[model samples]
Target: MIFPDNRYRQLRAIQAEDFHTCFYCGCIATEFDFAPPKAHWQSYQYRQLSADNLQVPACKECVALLKPCTMGLVQQRREWVHTKIAAKYKKAIGVYLKWNEDELEELDFSLHHSIAAGLKLGEESHRRSNFQGFSHEIDGSKVADVLPAAMPIVLFDKQFDSLKDAILYVCKNYPITQPKLVERLAEQGNNIEAVVMEIQEEQEVAQFQRQLKIQSAAFAKKHNQSARFVSNEVERYLDKELAYSIAEALDLLYEERVKHYR
Candidate 1:
């Protein structure tokens, strides 16, 4: 089953300047080359991708990689448009730093805020009413003693992909000490320099160890031999980029051993 999202639909005619090919497939796609999803992902499989924070791309084919299914080129093509938009906003923020208050307001912050918030949540679940008197707080404690004038308004699609992209954009483009902008946003109790979210580490090891113990105990009762196991928790501490590199190494080693046996 495939579900279309509205933010995907509204993203019909956008692209990043340097974005000449797909990130995964490396296919050349133009702004007109893609069409937006005409609702939302309503199936059981995509629910995990949405709520549980999977890093799967929003293509029909990518969704199908969930072990029991597959998605078509149409689905994959549909999602690159969004990547294009995210890339654009990143560029836009860089451009904004060149302008003053009057010039910045003319860029239409209200419309962008609406679009960004919708992408972060979803169409049906997203509400303008939800943003009333809302503000973003900067936690200087986590990063450095760096004083940011305000928090950047970053929109995350999944727990990792979109959020990381936004962070990279800020770090590459608008990273500076804008005291005036910071002070003004602080006065209003809302910052607009970066998006901040609460990050909680999952106690995966403890949970895994507890489950392993139960399984081992059951096995011992049947055959009186200890069940050996390995921990997969190394993924939690490594950054997503590094985790991929590590997974690749393990996967290649497994393949090599299989080839040697053959």
Candidate 2:
């Protein structure tokens, strides 16, 4: 696991607070990240950049997030990592930005817990992303915030604190179940109204199928034909003609086939 000294940056903490703290997110550092990374250091052009070859303390999560980054400058690399952190917790950030402590207090236990968890995550991520570098005591200099602004979740011309809230609201208003809605949303993308319509159409088709089976069984019993035979014929006719209803298909089957037999 040892890296070459010239190739890998030397570990250094600029300030006392920087020790054991993630340079990217301010979390407790469990690992070290090589600024410009070892791979980038291989390039002669990249090595020529006035990049500080410093190994900085980073949490496991930040290390993983920076795996693909090749920025040579430490500041640029830090900003890149912050961007990833913001994107990674965008939903949580939305929740944090949308609701305050007072609003969270009004929610029921389950909902309150759900939102509270999201808010906590959002707060941590928010802090980590905005975290300025450790203060420099020389003249008491401070760093500017690095976190990007977050956008709230919006649906049906309404804004939601989080995606979970939006999904809950949709489930309440629509006949679609939450699980099915979530499943379809993953398959169909974020068009909530379209997803609702798709589920409704599926329900209608399923209901019509059940009705057809029941009514066709009754028709089969009355006409002395096998239930499967009647159902199959009716379905075939309906498939041939999109406008044909089950009742119409059954009547046509009786007229065309049953009349000849009886």
Candidate 3:
């Protein structure tokens, strides 16, 4: 299903939290880009509504480049990409931190060349008249490379309970495969069954918290009080509930897949 206007706003908020730039290319992100591609979720198995975890803000150029890399390829190449991009980011950050204004301007061309060369994106990047806004190109690759390698990305400013849950969430919400999830978790040396257990516990906690909030909200409304007057406790609880709900949904999705496989 298409995301509602509020969901778009939620995506925008995520971008704003990340400084309103594409997480991969560091260019201004005008749209939400699903990492696994939303098209991956259109199959009969995954035909559920999309969730925010599968998305990251990305620029048009980066999106175009990434879309061609299928999920199978992504699973295979993710580690190499992460290692390379992390090294590049570390090196770039070191140079950036050490450079003064004059030094920065002097090295701008070379930095741009380095990014274009590294990613093999081509000469279009070089044709740009200015390099000032290009600093993020390096940073963007760094972020993109690490995403698949790292589990439990912070969304809406909260860490997911486990990498398994995060992967399952993406699979349920997007068109990703069970093997891809298994591969990612394996790369991290995590047992898929163990991770699922952890996710289950987290989901239960979230469900209990959500029920409490619902009851509290109902009570306030019954007393003719403003249900909108949410206390900080309620807000915090709600955020946790949301996080847990995503994990729970992922857990249910995974169970279905397991049954199908069996």
Candidate 4:
């Protein structure tokens, strides 16, 4: 999830309407209460790598949606570990605390915790605190990396939220082509490589589907199937890319076997 650090915003954005919706189920039920705030990183308070949490006022469906999100390979990366820690600290510790190098050191907390941890305090308060004393020490990094870094990120901003929505919602919506989608599917005890291969296979399947559509239309016209008329008309503009030479074979075929199929 793209947890926007409000510190990233150099300018204040007007929060005109409620945009905090259940990221997974697509429900905007702000009326739902935040249950006993789930603190994933509280145990790491003194740990070298404990970041703040990302608590949201989620309805039941939305909370359920997070189950899949909890499991990501991105969570396993070393960078992600420090990021989680940074995110947690960002949440639990406010901008007011100025660090002297001697007093504190920063590490990637998200990588340590393996997921974005939401602290006890909530959305509105999280925003106010996110910007109270912003720093921009890591301005050169990418937005995702910098969000949890010393750089400023506008936490829960609409644009950032939209990006988060796109990440989760796209993973949910596509569930196949998205790389994160495969990672989540693997975490659920599903076959990881198999899921990935399925995505790789999808292009072949789609090509076959189009091929069938075109071939069926041709056969229909020959045999006069009920839909042949419509198929022939549609065919005028369809099947424009089926041409190929004998020098190459389809992706899966051995040369001799390909000749048989041809």
Candidate 5:
């Protein structure tokens, strides 16, 4: 479902408060756009489709350019933004370096600490209570690192319909890296696959458990006894090894069924 009118107004207000210019091209923002192109909202179940989580101010140009963009393109844009910001800061630092060594050292230390503080504030800004309190304070220093970086854009040689496909591609191509960012991307890929596999396994196990429970209930009904009583009796009688053997046998039977059907 789409946002209601009142929620849309609220979202616009929030977007205006958070962003005055286009996030990508730095033009005066005409409207808010979803960073992940709202079109792909169906891909994420955990992320709430709200202003705070998804909205970013954009000019017409950026909106048009990015509306059809892939996740790889999005990652490239984000990294470009970070690289630009870092360059700007470094340039300012280079100007300061024209001073004596002592002054340069002081400025270097100050900038480092300031950036570190901004990073901390950006991280904490995810919390609703801290967002309003810290946003304005760190606005100047807040960079693309504030958001989760996408897996390396270079890995996407082919089109990907989802983030999972993009991540898997990256993992397959660049399995190891010494750079911290690449390492983090590799770890993220591993974690996503691990989590997805774990969830699938858990769901299959749950389905099997439910089927077993239903069978136990049916057996209990046949014997004119409570399901819980029958289940407990079965559990008591079926040792761990026996249960494992039964599961193995069931697996073989299912495999045979698949073979026969094929």
Candidate 6:
């Protein structure tokens, strides 16, 4: 049971039309959630910190996400809910970034239908995560919320509405896919060029390694050397820092083996 049970009241939107809108996501509000839950105000002084002691209308999902949150204000709860929503739907967000409606239309029926659902989910999650609450009043007096606005992000000499938009833009223009880019961004900070360069370098290294494996097998067979021997010699050279390139390492091993045979 809450201490200030009587003090807990529904936060009223100034406009009647905004009544059913979820204060966190602007979805059709199915229930209400108390910002700084009723149990939190253990003292009258603690309850006095919030001017309104607001209980904002929220969607069921938003309510569930915010259930464990212990924020002191509506704005904080909204921000927390947005962060959770973004994280929960990041894969869908990746789909949104990777493919657009026109591109989906060009796919085969089954593929289009499957991806289209993901794209729609991504779009809704993105929108809900960014929703700001409607204007509201506290005890018949309107007041401004202290909520901070979403800061626009600049990447690749282009300004985007948010980081999500920037990521989507990068996905469209670069060979890098959305998930890989997101992973690298977390690892490499927000430097778009650095992320792209690192991924490109990794791809090059992987390709070279694959080619080396095939070439080394052929080189071993031609030189009458067992593949294991060739591999062991190359590993020894690399471990000793004697050869940088696989070609150079293989050539050195072949020379040494030929001299031994002779």
Number of the top lDDT candidate: 6
Stretches of candidate 3 above 4 Å error?
1-17, 44-53, 72-262
**For residues 1-262, what per-residue lDDT tens digits would candidate 2 score against the true structure?**
5343655545545567567787677899887787777777667354477666667677899889889887777788788888899889978876765555667788999999999998899878877886765532212233332334335667757887655577778877878666566667657755666786777798899998899889999999999989999999998999899898889998899899999989
lDDT of each: 0.32, 0.75, 0.43, 0.34, 0.43, 0.76
Worst 10 residues of 1 by lDDT: 128-137
Q: Superposing all C-alpha atoms, what RMSD in Å does each candidate have to the true structure?
A: 24.4, 8.9, 24.6, 19.8, 20.6, 6.0
Output the lDDT of residue 240, model 1. 38
Write out the backbone clash pairs for model 2.
none
Between candidates 5 and 6, the lDDT winner: 6
TM-score: model 3 vs. ground truth: 0.25
- The parts of candidate 6 lying over 4 Å away from their true place are 1-6, 15-17, 43-52, 145-149, 171-175, 186-262
Our tally of clashes for model 6 stands at 0
TM-score of 1: 0.17
Q: How many residue pairs clash in each candidate?
A: 12, 0, 3, 38, 0, 0
Give a tens-digit lDDT track for model 6, residues 184-252.
876775576678667679888788768767877888778777777777677787777844678788877
Q: Candidate 1 vs candidate 2: which has greater lDDT?
A: 2
- What is the TM-score of each predicted model, taking all chains together? 0.17, 0.50, 0.25, 0.22, 0.26, 0.62
Q: Candidate 5: which pairs clash? A: none
* Tens-digit lDDT string for candidate 3 (1-262): 3353322222332222456665544467766555345455444226553333245555665555555553422222233333334343443432322222333345568785664343332222311111112122222233231233324444335466643345556556534364554554455454544545555677778777686567546644554444444333345544656654433433443354333653
lDDT of 1: 0.32
Model 1 ranges off by over 4 Å: 1-75, 97-262
Which order, best to worst by TM-score? 6, 2, 5, 3, 4, 1
* Model 5 vs truth, CA RMSD: 20.6
> In candidate 4, what are the lDDT values of residues 1-262, reduced to their tens digit?
4343432221111232324543122245342221112342333334435332323333354344333333222222223323333355553322212111222224365532322222223232233322221112223422231234233223233132322223344445444434455244436433333444565588677875576566555544554453444344334334443453111212112233323544
